[model samples]
Target: MFSFIIRRVLLVIPTFLAIAFLTFVAIRLVPGDPVEARTGERGISPERLAHFRHELGLDQPVWKQFLDYLWQIAHGDFGTSISTQTPILTEFTTLFPATLELAICAMLFATILGIPAGVIAATRRGTFVDYTLMGAALTGFSMPIFWWGLLLILFFSVDLGWTPVSGRIDLLYYFEPVTGFMLIDSWLSGQEGAFSSAVSHLILPTIVLGTIPLATIARMTRSAMLEILGEDYVRTARAKGLSPFRVVGIHALRNALIPVVTVIGLQVGALMAGAVLTEYIFSWPGIGSWLIESIQRRDYPVLQGGILLVSGIVIVINILVDLLYGVLNPRIRHAR
Candidate 1:
């Protein structure tokens, strides 16, 4: 297990490098002049434009610029954002936790609801319960996030006035950002109603972001449980007069979880991608919204660095999930 972990950790370096290089090259290929983005088309002088490019090292050959970027990255510099003029790392540290908080909430919502729904559907098999549940999952999986988020806002925020329209919390509450997570920070603040406010604001976006993951999880769980339920061991357990709930929940569900865990782990990447749309619709101040702004302003460093970091996180989580297989099924560990 130690050797396996070490191998995965080592692989992360090359994977990170490959993602970074691809992002760097891909951003340049997008037809937009960062200088022009910074300075309008009408007013900027030729000499000023040239100076700006030179200062940003855009005047250098592409290979030279790429090499300099690599060297800077090696020294732990993501470089400054051309538009914001802030260190990419600093911006990341500030904004990333917001995304993380949202993602965690979204995943929790998915898992809490999804797993049981799947189990119920599987157990019911050919009944209306199964059909209805599977139908809902398909709908959730097929719907676009932005549309779903907007519809939720219109219903809950606009018509019903049940939740805040946007933002992580109402601006009326003042709390020092200790962890950059609103829910925790609200509790830490001791400000009355702050935690509740954060939760209310979180509901719409969480539902929007989690819908796909929930649906996917439900489907995968249902499929896995169905297969496990038919196994010889399941039949034996049933014949042994074990309670149906115990037989299914303890034995069948546990065995079925390997694939379900894999699906859940893979959904992290999807959640991040979906967060982009969800954040935009809800106007949430997270890395997703920040990345959108960076793209508009043509901030190359933030674009490349942010994508690299998020991808790196996804890769790490996937590695952890693979390791978890050994814990879930000891045979995997012994085989390795």
Candidate 2:
């Protein structure tokens, strides 16, 4: 596992360069110039624009700028945001953890709910229980995460007064921004007030982001479970007087989880991608919301840095999932 992880890490270096190179070229290919975007109409004159260009190294050749940026990245600098003039790495580092927390929570909710729901549907095939679970999963799949978030807020918060509308905590509670995750800090500090507010605030967004993954997991789980249940081992288990519950849960569920894990991993990557909309809706201080603002302002450094960061995360998670496949299913390991 250690050697495998090291190999994956080594591979990501070239992957990063390739993604960065393509992204840099693609963004620059867009019609508007960042310099003009900065100056705006009736703004700075040509001389000032020229000075700004020199200051930002925009006067340099494109390849030179790209190579310079890569060099800086190698040295742990992500450059300053074009609009804000703040270090892109600092800004992103502060914001990303919040999004990470939200994504992790959503993934957990999806796994906790989706897999079991799928298994239930599979085990109870052709029954009302099966239909109801699958029906719910289908509906969940159809709903967009942002739309789902708004509906949840409207119904649960406004109409029902069940949960908070936005943000990560009650304004009244006012938990310190330790670790950028209110729920985590609340638990870490053992403060009931903070914990309650954090959990309550997380309710709507978590459910919203969790819905699609739940649907995907449920469908995969059902399919995998059905296939596993039909395997001869399952038949033999039943023939050996194993209870239906054990036959399905113990005998089939673990094996079925291999593919389900992959689905969940891909879902996690999607959740991070979707988080931009989710954070914007919820007014959460996360990378997605920040990235959107950067793009809107043509903040080149921030945009590129954020995209690379997300790409790296998605890539890492996928590699982790691949390694887990070997760990879970010994056939692959033995074949190796």
Candidate 3:
């Protein structure tokens, strides 16, 4: 297990490098110059323009610029944003964790809701429960995240008055900055009231963002559970007089988790990818919204940095999920 984990962790480096390189190249190929885009129609004088290019290192050869960028990246410098004039890494820190939390909450919500719903649906196969759960899952799986977010806003925010439609925290509740995340900081500061408010604000977006992934997990879990329940081992366990709960929960469910874990991991990645829409809808300040702003402004450095961070996060999560397979099914890992 240790050896396998080591291997998986080691593999993340090159994979991230490849993603970073691809993102950098792709951003460069886009048809607008960050400087020119920001400078607008009043063309600057030749010397001033040259100075700007040199400042940004655009005056250097393409290959040299790439290598220089690589060197800077190695030293933890992500370049200054043309639009914001802030270090790319600096902006990323402010934005990344918000999205990370949102994605995590959404993922957890999905799995918690999806898995149990799936288990019940599978256990009660061909029943009304199955039909009802499947129908809900189908709607969730088919609906778009953006569309879901708007619906949630309309229903929960406007009509029901159950939750706030957008933002990460209630402006009425002030929180001290301890960890940069409002909920955590609020808790650490012993302000449960603020924390509760923050959580309330998060509920709608979390559900809206999570619905699709939840559906995915439920569908996968149901399918996998059904397949496992019909296997010889399941019958053997039942024949041995094990209680139905023990047979299903302890034996079949444990083994069925391998594929479900895979689906959940993929859904996690999907949630992170889907957050751009979620963030926009909620007006949540996060990397996804930053990416959108970068694209609109042609802030290549910001765009590349954000893309690399997300790709790296997704890759790392996938690697962790791959490692989970060994833990879930030792037979697969120990197989000759």
Candidate 4:
């Protein structure tokens, strides 16, 4: 298990390098010049442009710039945002909690409901319940996030007036963000209706963000459960006259969770990707919105650093998930 964990941790180095390099190259390949974009119309003089480029180290050769970027990151410096003049790391930390909160809520929403739904579907295979649940999962998987978000907003927010249109909380509640997670902070603030308001604001965004993950998790769970249920132990447990719940839940579900856990971990990336669209639609104040604003202004440092940071987070999560495989199924560690 220790060796397996070490291997996974070591693998992150190369993975991070690859992601960082690709993000660096890809952002540079985009047409807009950050300096020019920041300056906007009524362009600066040629000398001034040259100075700006040099100041940003853009005048350096691509190889040198890449090396410098690597060196800076190695030293824990993500560099100051070209647009904000603030350290990228500082801005990321400030905004990350919101994204973290949303992602957590979304994943919780998916896992809480998806697992049971999948179990039911698999247990009742070939029945109407199975078909209906599977169909809903397929529809959810197929839905475009932006379109789904709008549809929900129109119905729930616009017409029925059940939820707020955007933002993390109602403007009426103003208090210092103790934890940056509105739900927790609201409760901590002891402000009347603050916690409820935060929950209400989170509802639509969580649903929109969680839909695909829920679908994926549910389908994966069903597949895993189906296979596990067919195992000899499952039949043996049933033949032994164990309760149906014990046969399925304890024996089958535990063994089945290995693959389902992997799917859930992979969903972190999906949740983050989906958060961009959901945040934009709901005007949620998270890193997704921050990244969008940076992109509009062609903020290269923020774009590159932000993407690298996000990728690092995803890679770390995947590593943790890989380690969890050992705990779920001891055979995985033994095999390694």
Top model by TM-score, which number? 1
Q: Per-residue lDDT of 1-336 in model 4, one digit per residue for the tens? A: 677668878878998899888878887888878988978888899999999899888999988999999999999999998877999999999999999999999999999989989999999999999999999999999999999999999999999999999999999999998889999999999989999999999999999999999999999999999999999999999999999999989999999889999999899998899998899999998899999998888888898899989988988888888788877898877787
Task: Point out where model 3 deviates above 4 Å.
Answer: 41-47
The lowest-lDDT stretch of 10 consecutive residues in candidate 2 is 169-178
Better of 1 and 3 by TM-score: 1
Give per-model TM-scores: 0.98, 0.93, 0.91, 0.97
Query: Which residue pairs in candidate 3 have backbone atoms (N, alpha carbon, C) closer than 3 angstroms, thus clashing?
Result: none
Candidate 3 lDDT by residue in tens digits, 159-229 = 99988777888777675566777679777877557888789888987898889989998999898999999
Task: Give a tens-digit lDDT track for model 1, residues 236-273.
Answer: 99999999999999999999999999999999999999
Q: Give me candidate 4's TM-score against the actual structure.
A: 0.97
RMSD of 4: 1.2
lDDT of 1: 0.92
| Runs off by more than 4 Å, candidate 4 | 334-336
| lDDT-better candidate, 2 vs 4 | 4
Off by over 4 Å in 2: 1-3, 31-35, 38-42, 189-192
- Ten contiguous residues with the weakest lDDT in model 1: 36-45
